[model samples]
Target: MRLLDNIYAGERVSAADAVRLFELNLTELGAVADFRRRQAVPDERVGYIVDRIVNYSNRCVACCEFCAFHADAGMIAPYDLSFEEIIEKIGELVVGGGTQVMLQGGLHPDHPLDWYLDLLRCVKTSFPHIWLHSFSPAEIVHIAILEGMSHGEVIGRMKTAGLDSVPGASDLLVDSVRRRVSPRKCTRGQWREVMLALRDADMVSSATMTYGLDETLEERVEHLCFVRTVQDETGILQAFIPWSFSPANTRMCEVAPAGGVDYLKTVAVARIVLDNVDHIQAGWLTEGPELAQLALCMGANDMGGVLTEELVVQAAGIHTRLTAADMEDLIQNAGKIPMRRDSRYQELGHEG
Candidate 1:
């Protein structure tokens, strides 16, 4: 009762309290989270984005254990998308009414910083209106290492090259889990440095958490608290996205995927604790439409993106897709108005 009272009084849920909240009955837990959600977003509208993901290359050096997406430097044939190929993809997105494009790829050992800059320039110069939400912190760190520049310098160059925003990806955000999942990736400090650099550059980004690996409940809270604290200090995170770790078709196939109920509880807890973060997204690309709908009742206010073209999670053997109409219908059925938005959560239109 005290926990519920504190939450209702608008007090921030502590890391310890957040972990304790997990032990409550799932339905009750969801209700408390829903109350917080209503407080944050009083409007009956839920947001969705029409977007596509374009992989610039498949060659990677930081081969994470949980990822089934990248082709190792010598293990498989590598492919890099040419300017013509990427332009064709952007053309497809424009034809589909997509206003945003997610540009991401693994760290290739050969490509210089200019190559990445050229890719961003090619898209932004051609489609000046499209939002280029590209690159992860790890990717930024890789570019900095290759170019012998500071993180701030790399971000400045990226912005000048037309990079609009970054996806909160890579590094588990907890050093223990990060070492377990992606040892070759950048450290937690390195990732945070990149984020601070983004904030200094006056750019926006989303924060993400991939749970259900070897992390404990307390560790999960730590991940959320870390991002919440960062939001308090930087004020640059536009949203928060939490998804389950896909364990199939990777070196961690022996591990089981997190159940649907766990995903719901996670969404609820995220809303309860991340008071500073405005939006909490239901990762429908991995959670599917039905589960994502239920997540709306729990705390999620956004349905992520339409994911016109996605490959990373698919490579992990979890395949799901949805159209703009499908997403709108899902939100309507969940008793919320469906709003089409861009990466910045600015509503483009209400009609599909």
Candidate 2:
């Protein structure tokens, strides 16, 4: 109760307090988190984006144990989309009134840095109006390691190639958990460095957490605190997304998936811990639309995007897609105005 009192008094919650907040009953925690959400976003509007996630290549050297999407180059015939194919995908998104495109892929060992640069150049040349929110910290770090460059240098080149923003797709930001699950992926420190590089480049990005990876509650709090510290220093993180990890068709499939109660609690706790971040997104694609609607009422103010094509999560045995109209109806059903937003969280327009 004292913690709740301090939170209401405009005081920031400590890491220890965040860990303890997880112990509170779901309803009580939601009440406090919803209160904070109202303080940060007072309007009755919830935002969604019209976007697509384009996987350029599935050939990856970083064989993360938790990913069912990455193809093993030796066993599986890895596929890379040619420039024409990728452009066609973006063209379709453009025709559907999409304003953002997230181009993410695995760590392809064979491609040179120019391959990625040319891809960005080609996409920009074709669809100059689409916001290129592509690449995760792991992808950026992979490029740096392959090209013998620093993270900042690689991000600088990416920005020149018309990359609008980066996505915080680091599965979990705990080094121990990373070792257990995605050992070949970027370390927690490397992920933070890439984010700092984005800040230095004057770019914007969203932070994400994929929980229920057999990690402890304290580890989850640590992840939230890590993002909060980064935002406090750079003010670059625009949104915080906490989603349950899907374990189907992956090496970690035996791990029980997080249920609806855990999902909402994590979202609420993230909202309370990440006081500096502006937006919290409901993970509709992973948790289903109904639970995502509950999350909006709990603490979330964003419904993520109408991802026209999402492969990674689909590979994990979860499939959901939404048209722009469906997004509006879903938000309206939750009793909030659905506003169209760009990648930068800039309001486009909403129907009255």
Candidate 3:
């Protein structure tokens, strides 16, 4: 097949066409994938940072069947981190050398929009340097619906209140699929609308995909195409991250996680498909460091972050934790430069 020729020449292919490219053996695939990576990001290398995911609240209204972190409606111990408590967590993260704080949480039923705005302001006020790269479009949509406000208004208010950027958790961009898993959540159109508003306001963010559930390969490609379209339209995507769905504590535990081969294949296809995006982030949290390192050869330019703390995945079942030094070692062992990056893809530091 002329797959490598088209990919190297920067031609988009359909998902059906892309699947044929994955049929090649590991050695051949690795060579082509590595060549593509070199072509895309030559002098630059994949980077990651030691950061923490301090989920402020687990009480959720949009209970996704695939999510294991959402607490039940009457579930007690669904603690909301007070301003003092969150500040302490940020202090610890900063002292531990974490430059970013992934402040994610569920859609707390009663918390006003000011609750989140106040949280963002408090985080920025307490630690002026810590990047509060928090919240997903889904969460924003949920809040807007509850507050009886438009998506644009909620996102504008949050951006003014000091949200750094959106997290890549829009999941499937198709509503039929999302309804199967998360009926109560925002529609796909709503999610995209929220992201569009954020982009229009000049806040760039990352996009993500969670595969290996009920979605087909064609659907996955559709998701990628949607991302590419949005990136082209908005010009605000910093990276693309594709992760496997972990069915641990979720209602969909019967569905198996995506295998390493499938994960690498998707990453390779993503590189070929999303030609406009600058970076492709491989999920070490879901695929482990070894497979994540292998993804570097399979066209991924970012090794994601060394999460000092995580909940969504932990709630799912996988536990692959690493330090900044460990991430450096992984990248070095994989024969790629280990550069540290801030929330944006700007190189913050480098290590051997």
Candidate 4:
């Protein structure tokens, strides 16, 4: 099947398409997908950037078997960021020319919904112009359950408290798989409901899939189809970000790790399948810096972030950090222009 025709069909390509995508010469696949994206979004140029992930709390009850970042219940000192501590972090972020804040953390077992609300309000009231791109669907569901609030009400309160958007982070969007992997977190249906609610409220979010962890290729494609189906319903999902599952200190896949070729192949298929989503972000955090740079040529336009600090993937034992200048260098090294961007991909400026 021709790439353009496959894209125009506006449907999820079959497993055969995924296999074909996998078999294509890497350069050939890159050229075809890049060309298609250009035709659809002509004015867009390179250099999509998001700010650092500032994890405020490490305490969590959702002790996912796949996670290495969750603090155990018997830890000596579990610190939640005091308002002043959070403000200090934000002060550094702003002065460093950061544009957005990705505030995610473990599900602090005992904190009230108001605890999150107050922190959000403090950040927004202090820096109203900064994009507060925070929270995942799992966190939302957990918070709602803890607060005894409906998902919609939780989103409303969050928006009122200053949430600019959600991260769409319900990893492995298939229920049977999730039930085995992250049973304590939000189920697939619950995650979808949360995203639907955010979409209904006119918020933009990005969907993600972390593969290379006990799921077959069919399951991977199924996950892509699920995200596309949601996009068809709500039309508010902004991007699709597929990251390889990191098996560092996690209980699952203790020795197996996702390779670069696998990562690129997944990106190629994602570009072919998720025709509705405008942007595809390469997870620089999960796949090292070099692979992330290579991802630009392999169908990913956005190299995820100028992440000043990130602990989620780091705790899982992958440490590939990049500054704003470093990202500009990576884009240039990949032979594409790097254009600095905000949460919505509005070109704020160019770094190089």
Give me the candidate number with maximum lDDT: 2
Candidate 4, number of clashes: 3
Instruction: Please give, for residues 6-124, the per-residue lDDT of candidate 1 as tens digits.
Output: 99899998899999988988889999899999998978789998888998787888888888888852333578888999899989999988999998888778988888889888888
Residue 87 error, candidate 2, Å: 0.5
Q: What is the lDDT of residue 24 in candidate 4?
A: 74
lDDT of 4: 0.80
Task: Tell how far residue 325 is off in model 4, in angstroms.
Answer: 1.1
After TM-score superposition, what is the CA distance of residue 343 in candidate 4 from its true location, in Å?
A: 1.4
Please state every model's RMSD to the true fold in angstroms: 1.5, 1.5, 1.9, 2.3
Candidate 4 lDDT over 1-352, as tens digits, reads 5744755554457655766676777777776667655654554356567576788888888877777777762322466778888778878888988889888887778878998899899999999888888988988898899889989999999898999999998578877788888888888888789978998788989899988878877788888888888888888888888898777767774648878888987887787777788888877878887888777776678877777778777777777777788888888888887889888887888765
Q: Rate the local accuracy (lDDT) of all candidates.
A: 0.88, 0.90, 0.82, 0.80
Give a tens-digit lDDT track for model 2, residues 1-352.
7998998786899999988987888889999999999999999799999999998888888888888888852323579889999999999999988999999888888988888889999999988899999989998898899999999999999899999899888577999999898888999899889988999999999899999999999999999999898888889999998888888888888999998999999999999989999899999999999999999988899998988888888888887878889889999999999999988888999744
Candidate 3: clashing pairs of residues = none
TM-score of each: 0.97, 0.97, 0.94, 0.93
Query: TM-score for model 4?
Result: 0.93
The CA lDDT at 112 in model 1 is: 86
Q: Which stretches of candidate 2 lie over 4 Å from their true place?
A: 73-77
Worst ten-residue run, lDDT, model 4?
70-79
> Deviation in angstroms for 252 in model 1?
0.5
Candidate 2 or 4, higher lDDT?
A: 2
